[model samples]
Target: MKHQSSEYVVVIGGGFSGLATAGLLAASGHRVTLLEMQDSLGGRAGRLHRDGFSFDTGPSWYLMPEVIEHWFKLMGTSTTVELDLVDLEVGYRTWFQGHPDPLDMTTGPGAVAAFESVQTGAGVALEKYLAYAETSYGLALEHFLYDGFSSVRSLLNPRLPALLPRLAPLLSRSLDSFVAQRFSDPRLRQILGYPAVFLGSSPKHTPALYHLMSHLDLTQGVKYPLGGFAKLVDAMAELCTKAGVKIVTGATAEGIDTVQTGRHTRVDSVRWSDSRGETHRLDASVVVGAADLHHIESRLLPRKLRSSSDAAWKRRDPGPSAVLICLGIRGKLPKLLHHNLLFTQDWDENFGRIRRGEPLDTETSIYVCMPSATDPGVAPAGHENLFMLIPAPTLPEWGTGGADGNGSEQVEAVADAALAQLAAWAGIPDLAERIVVRQTFGPGDFVNNVNAWRGGALGLAHTLGQSAFFRPANRSAKVEGLHYAGSSVRPGVGVPMCLISAEITAKAVNGIKDLGPFSMDGQNRDAREPEGDVQEERVAK
Candidate 1:
């Protein structure tokens, strides 16, 4: 709770992380200014409203409800209006090539019985597996993700040495390998491994430590914030304003001007342009570049002041982008549910083609979200709002049959073919014909709208070496008083991780020192508590 007072902190980007950072800083008695390039806020989590249809354009799955509750509580806001969280009875449905019926997944005691119903003895394994996953999840929030870490030295804490044995899986194994080793059924394996898609990496490439995500999915639960992600955006903006933070939208940040002292260089001010082509420079003592990490570093800051090298960035694995198609249908689609994941048997090949900058796979794996099924207000009466997404490479103009990889025209052709395939696979014979409102956002849209580096829909890829303390640090090593938060920074991608990143960076801004990556819990924990005591708390009632 300790903080630096009376400093003017300028936050670039009005996204979730930026809003959280600005609110935290202002609440700590600092003067904060948040500049967002877009006319409205929400960044990637932006909403689309047209002709009586509303859809969360980016993140649809609302996981980690605790993060939101904790954030609101910390900001001294009432959690009553936080979200009308609905616990999905059927979290999602997955369609496999030859499967007769779709797979229905849920959480808690019933979940154990359900898995056991599918495969003998598998339910017993699930119960035990989730218990293990819960332990990992607790260790994550309590030890590392919530705590501030500036350098590798954070890992040198005394507590970490005792925790090293448990951390070996994160260092040595992958999620897919872990699932394969645990479950025998391929259907169940896919169900367990699908959570990796949120991390924006292949299960084979994601670290095994991320299996805690399974605990979140299977044991904990998936939630939908009534009114979509935009509700959180509204609440966050309101919180920031209440905390006396200035929110400026449609203000595009062009550069971060610096002033060099004897040994360190400090961000002097930020130069930004409004929608009308008017440019202005605002002075600041601290700057939080939360827009896009790579975009800010490569374009906003001077080359000489950048701490990360282009070669180093290239060496790191980037997360998968997407080709998102939001269709407002004219008729009801009973074949789909709140969340549907359609996959071909060639799952690995699908990921391979997408990750390698090749065109989308012939048999693409698609995620179709029909929120209207759960919330009638999201669509017109007797109709469904279909949000379709294909995890794709962040390429220029590349489409299934686009010319030279940059034409939006080719994206339409790609969309048509994919829709036909989706209809056949999902057993919805008239899928394409139901569209009354259509919007296609490809990689080209990603770059133009949010300045996404390489059209990345997710943050940086959560590869082995690119994870944990190895990911980009929240605090800048070269620029004094400059910090970062969001999917691109440490703790990796996802809405929950971004919230944690905001907390970590906020604490750091308030003069909290990084206790290395594995120091004991900093918030509400006795500094003297030994790391050996780290364990999962009881499940929330």
Candidate 2:
């Protein structure tokens, strides 16, 4: 059942999407060579080491355990074997600006109790909301996420007609409005709406359909990989290597070489520069642009060959950027949990400033991750690992940052303000003095390092028009063998979405279209193989 033909595939960017794409394609009998611009892999899910502390500089919250487990299973392994995942007792701690006591959020009965404490009958309301969320989550996983909307006819599934009534309101309304309809308390609404930030959007702009995100954490509970996100990256890299994919680090893709065949055009090879500034080109029958889609479209591909042009991108929202603060503290912070969120009272105004391209707010929502609480290996015995994220506008005017706050004034100012805010809000007045090591990464770093569009921390915002079939297509309209896989493409951002993007791109390359999730029994078989070939396997399953 293995693929009979093996074509040379070149994957650009060694991020989660790129690494996952390479591994999947290689496993399907393609000779894959992945090029990463950075010295190391992981892209946005990056790790930083300072003093005796290790910080997950990028994504920390490990949501969607099922997706991760599915990915590991696809790679011919299990999550239990590849990762040491710990289910957090407390999902996260939310501290309001003026409130003295912090609210600890957890799944199931604990979550209900927390909500009930805030408002009478809120626990019942929460259960109702979660019921809808869980249903949407299941429906999306079955009918939407895995399927590539290659044709209009693909939308005509029998199940969709019955489900559309339930989904219509979710798609049309904003998440903020949706949550407000269910809960009167602002804290309850904020708790439900804050997940929109993970989608690189504001709750006011994000579709209510994203409420399904709550089901992942509020129902299933939050989990963390013991060694930070780097462990997940390392595991993916190892899988790619095992699948015979050759990974090249410090390789910056300069251009995509193409050749015309009659009326059609296809990618020929990828030309990249190594760390030593030496140029090299490797012929590729197929090319997957798993990096920043904007970077790939604007820089690598030729103007005429580009599927999404600069003009097209200008019309889209590039999403909010962030000022990332990584700290290595000398003492323990018992007040903080493994995950902490400091939310401003005014959610609308805070989001409005970023959406309107206004200046950074004096009072803004910020997320803090203390991974050391769960994993002792991340920091020294007496120290704690702290990572803070302050979401900001993707405006180039905001400037950049560097290690120890040596770079742009604006970037350092934001970091300083965030620290003061954290200290005051969390009741740690000497938090700044406790910092033994510090590093600040700004929007500009996203541009300089990952070639992120408008220095965006995440890719395109998941606005209604920028979602689902409306998102930039995975395969190029002009080029035959050109495909895209990553945050910017269909199925949207996050590590789980990126992994799904990889599978979609891989399946498309193998001539499968509009297919749902792969069956466990058919894991090793080519998806595009004739039905007769896998009939016996299907029967056995």
Candidate 3:
């Protein structure tokens, strides 16, 4: 294991994907510098601390443990050593409107019983659905998620044709219809279809291929890094530092300087501004745009060197924007769980409003997280930490937000409605009054802070048109020595996908086209080897 070539690599955006890309490149013997606009490294996976309460500003659920573990192992560490991960006993609690009680979802017999209680023979349907999901998950891990789609031959596996029949329907049909076909109960369908939100899509728009998300939560279960998602961010930042990455926070990337080398335009250096408005330049052999792809291309690079144009981006779905409400309540929320979902009875109408770019609906579905239930460190003693996520349209009409009710009318109104809903549904009528600290983050905040396209909270929606090989490539099609790694790019959204995206980007930078998971031995294996052989090696290890 030696340096492939000591190229200077500049990774823009200090999010999970950015940090992971910087660390992997550094580990592979590249001189790396990571630039983050925020004062902190974590982008969306940010932390908000106020009045002795700490809230994970973005992602909370820790699914896909293997993906997390794989990245840690690659960095010469283990999750057991680096992260104190707690396997949540109850994956999540769901409260459907009009239902008398909430369903606490776990795994095995309990999950079956919960579903069976809702609809006759629904328990059996769940088992069948999960079986398909587990198979799909395994297939994706083996053949799809890891591959960068560098070559058409990357998908020319002998096993693929055999699996195509089973996979075709999943790829073509909407997740909503797929779940509806299996179970007649709306609750069961919601449980199966709700994972679409994680992909920044509604079930109607998201392909059923994403049903594999169910396997990650239902079969494998959910885990939380002990201090909160911020701990995971801390771990990633630490790993990047240990791998010799120079992380510069509060440094905004102004533009990417390029050189026309022969027939290709290559990134020469990145022009950035510091917190004090000091301009600086860093020469690099390669640049990874780990931020929002739309921001990177439209703003940073010159139009001639841009891979995706304004017209191109318009055709793509920027995914759903969200309004995040963080609250520090005065007393314990007995009814709240670490993870909770409040589903509206009319799923079609709720999601339809979002798709049509309508205003936030009165009865929209919401996700609430009470991390204090699992981690005492998040909030002061006797108080509760609450976070509510409402998926809204990417429309600017919703506006931005601030601390202690200092937000635009539309944003605050959504928060107000969420609090009222929580009080009514969770039996906590005084939820609003008990809030000792209140903060709201909306679409405008996403655009202002992260340069999100159209204020989309997540990168791109995982629709049939924007998935897998159809998604944007990691390497720049127009510029040489330019790459991408993040939710906006390949494997899709979520912390785990971002980590995997880093590996894919690293492989492209290393000039290794092996469409399999990179070996932990720090060796670039032959690209010609079947991906199954690599899987076998991992298992044997």
Candidate 4:
């Protein structure tokens, strides 16, 4: 049966990905309704406030500002309206326990010189490696990321024949192996491979394509909106509303209403519950499940329409879940940057424990976000907003190794130990004493907040076998009108990638061309553009 092109679209999840997809669809002159179970938006990257301090609970750092710019521009909105984007100077710091000096990464020549000083010829090796990363970046941006990935044929396109060779180099070997091949110095290797933790995978499992993150940060630069990461969310949500999209927060989708006729199953409506405990069923021509893909398929959809357990989404390639300790400090640490990393002595063993669902090392590596150093407004005067993340196992059986029996208590204990160790490593005295406010989200929190199966923080780990075309498809093979986006879906994790996931899903539903080249958002990905006409004013909060 033929249908109207301007059919009403309902997005089940209202995270960055869902919101972005709805925005893109609305911009295209389609009626888009976004349903968010939570009271507020931003999902994993949501915000929290206690006393006079404000905390960016999820998505502490904003990498690749250009990707964000391209998104806003696609919606015909200027970035200046929602955020005051600024480039961070001190890239980050890496401490190797007993080293005489801390590895502080500056913007350009200084960083190159620092690497050269650490290892005899690492600067040259880094140059070559970065060149390769740039090639991979261009290839990924132009061919793999921006397009709608449905079948293997999409990747093996005759129009983009050059992709095969580049794809090999990008996904050929492990990022750890690539780093080891390039840099002889262990410290240099650690610094380069450190960011892999954010991808929610061990260095050995993550593909070399992720090495492009180096170029994105060092060359392209790390940026932050004047507000927190939430500013981008606000901006995107505003675009969706201006494009005539309706956003309903605190609305939980309970079930799907479908009609089956012979071979086809058609989605007729959606059953949902709001924060007020009222239930409503709305008719929808097509449904985009922007939440976790696993949840949508396994839990949200009926059993008959679901696929059997696949290794990629099941036991194998499961990503590491994180336990984040977000703190609003009373004062700033003098040596920290907008972004910094405190490395543990044994990263291999650390990942090993996490892979097996064990407690992380007390001296575990921590990614610290100090936005207050760049933009003072994030915290109160003379204070800082910090997020300390320790990636650990999501297994329910993972006990606290004596720190309160259960994983939550264990997470807090380990986080406390991590902060103490961080203070010693960075030479910051009484670091824990200065904390005026603290909030934490462990693997347990991840499950409760987003219905992330098994409390997996980011979706599936970006292992070599589960990359690009290998990842789950945007459109569900089980359900005709149901689509998937966000971290779990292709292209991968992170705020930018989540946005790209939305774009890909939108294109799959509307049969429109995906948005143009965007800077990487979320994990590794291309998000959707706003659907209809871009609007300037803010939506009703």
Candidate 5:
């Protein structure tokens, strides 16, 4: 077979991690063939469009905007060209028990005050807890996350020795346990533990290191893209095309083929079924798997090497599969801000039922994203593109409340109920009547489109046992020329971490030097814009 020196690297799922891997590899002087099964590239960050209104699919919360921008600039474009990001003043509103007014946790001290309102010294306790979170977050970025840990020896580095003291605190304790120890009030505990679910796992199971979410949100701040996350994906897609990467949409990957002799193995190529149902094979020097870890392991790789029997592998990693309700409303919701979180009174019971695979509580928590409140471009004139999500488990256990094994129908009903609840919770006037166009994505929808294993919205649970070295490594242990990225792999979930994971994976594939994890702000400050930027010129179709 003829081979190209700048190998035709086939990137299997075109989510944030997959695209980032493809884009960086192409920019670094390698030819890349990106294969995405869906009609779109964003993966979990899916897009919905109707009557000139656009809505972001899954991940509505935009943190670390600079991570996307930095990669784009590296490939000759800035985020500004395709998406306008506005920093939120009130990051999120949490309605604690007994407090009539919800806690607007934009300011750090205000979050401290929420605890203070419950007890005299709770504010001081929170300050101390936040200080500890800050310390662990700094250590994690500097030592644990940035470097690729090829083996256990690599994790025992002397530089990371200082992190040893924190490892017990961060690794041994769950987010819920850590918060309960620090706060006497259950209300304060709920508010603090809420962000842990962003990992897609419940706070009781998620690691304490996830406390970084507080720093990432309340301190670093939350941002919203002008046209939602889809705009950001579109911007990156434009850059990839300009960089000469071959993006094949509507192409479903089948599996990989590898031949081995002694210690070395050659990945011959990848096979995929396109829209026409014709099987297409492309020879490649390298292959990167960007889809779900289980899909890549079971469907794509040879069966002998799969980890189906491993206890850790078989255990369900509960990521809250979101039921997104997108509405193209006839008019704007002036009372709603750019971002809002509507909390239910019995939040614990709600999560308990979800974890148990029962129906989500009638009064479940909801996240509302009103992009028109910030960018105005997402919705048509005098209209709004509203995205509301209720987090729930992907799988439905037997004999659960009204779920009846058909998760799609049950989840859709839950989405409708949640929307109705949201309108009442937030006091939105005539919200049900205002929606001119609407759609919903349930667990089955995520499974069919993204091929997310068991319809898991996020990858693995970010618990102490499943994070960092515990996560499936970027470099496959048994398979050569096969690598993993996306939510399941290292650096964990979210757009920033996904992009970072891709960068590190590409470096490992190319044998390039590791660049330590830098903050989104740090990257923008250090990296220079290319002259005559490609983003300035429209790509020749």
Candidate 6:
């Protein structure tokens, strides 16, 4: 962990990826400066306080514990000591449209029995599917997750031709078809299928390969940081500081300046605007775009320096945008758990409307996270902190009751409808009256606050073509000393994936080996360690 004075690395965006990237680079001996546009360090993971209610406005569920452990280990710290982790006994509860009782799922393996109770043979089906899912998860971790996609060749191998026969099933079918073929109960299907929306795609469109999420969902189990996602973000920042990474918040990187150094034009400095609107410049040998990749490219760099044209980005399918509502209720929500999924009867129809850029229909699916159920401190005593998310398409216009769709003002309308539906489904008739505080974020807000492209919550869809090496490359072939990370890059989406993305990007930018053959063949790590090391020669195909 020796510091190198010769090279300086400028990491853009102080989000999870930026923090991780800067920390790793600093450990590897590069002078690191992390610039964040917002006033805080955590980008989407930042907290919002309204009327004494605390909210993790973006990510709520902390699914992959191994990723977090591996992250701290890389930083030479203990995750357990730095952050408190708790297993959510009831991982989540589902209020399906027709089901008489809300389905309660636990964090441990006991959830199999619960699924079986819904449908006679569902428990067996779930076990069998998890077995297959585990193998796919191993393959994905081996081939995709750990490495930076520097080139198209990263996605190919000699064994790919052989695996084409085995890949037929996954490549041909959607996640909907994969689970629907195995499970008979509609409730079970919705329960399994609903996670695809978290990745910004519906099960009907998401690739079957993403079934690996099921392995994380039921088998690996859901856990959380005791306080909130803010605690986890704080832990990451603390680790970054200890690793000697300089964090610069309230400073926006406006443009990346490059100089021709032999065969390539290398990024040498960055021009940024500070909180007081004062402009500053920092020189660096390497530049990492930890912010919105498209925004960094189109907004910061000249058109000639950008790797992808505007049309090329439009060609890629941006994932779903969300209409979010954060609330503080006066009384407890007895009918709700820490996590609640309000599934609609017309699930497919809901997805269809969103895909068409239409607003959420009357009978729409809403994901409600009641943090107060898990921690009382998030809200006032005897009160509740509630965060609701509705998946809507990223339309051109966002406003209340516009011809195109509903705007930010329409949040109350939608929240009222969602409350009425929740109360009816959960037998809590007085759910609407308990609200003491409320705030809403629409597509326009995402555009303004986060520089989100078309207000997309997640970067890109994990469709078959959009995933793997088909995504934007980490290393820039057109520009030297430039890299990209976060949801938009390969091994896409999720908070945990961002950690891996930063590791791979740092490896690429810092001129490290990047575990090339090591990650695929699992030749570097010991056999006993089972977090992500894949021992077999199986990767692609």
Per-candidate TM-score against the hidden true structure? 0.92, 0.95, 0.95, 0.90, 0.88, 0.91
Q: Using lDDT as the measure, name the better of candidate 2 and candidate 4.
A: 2
RMSD of 5: 6.2
**lDDT scores in order:** 0.79, 0.87, 0.87, 0.74, 0.73, 0.78
RMSD (Å) per prediction: 8.3, 5.9, 6.7, 5.7, 6.2, 7.8
Per-residue alpha-carbon lDDT of candidate 4 for residues 55-101, written as tens digits (9 for 90 to 100): 67778667766566667876777777667887777677777867747
At residue 154, candidate 6 shows an lDDT of: 56
Between prediction 2 and prediction 4, the one with superior TM-score is: 2
Higher-TM-score candidate of 1 and 4? 1
The clash count of every prediction, one per candidate, is 6, 0, 0, 27, 0, 3
Question: Runs in model 5 with CA error above 4 Å?
Answer: 1-5, 80-82, 96-100, 109-124, 307-312, 396-408, 513-541
Q: Alpha carbon lDDT of residue 538, candidate 1? A: 23
Of 1 and 2, the candidate ranking higher by lDDT: 2
lDDT of 1 by residue, 1-541 (tens): 4323456689998888999888877776667789999988889997888899998988888877778777787787655766677878887877877776777677787778767877899998998889888999888876778755575557677788788899886669988899888888877777778778888888888888888888887877788877888887898999999877788898888888889899879988888888888888887888998878999899998788787999988887778888788788888888788999877777788778877888775567788899988888899998998888888887856532222223376566567767887788777887776778887877777777788888888888888877877888887778998888898887778887887788787777666675422111233322212434321212112
Clashing pairs in 1: 154-516, 154-517, 155-517, 397-405, 397-406, 398-405
Better of 1 and 3 by TM-score: 3
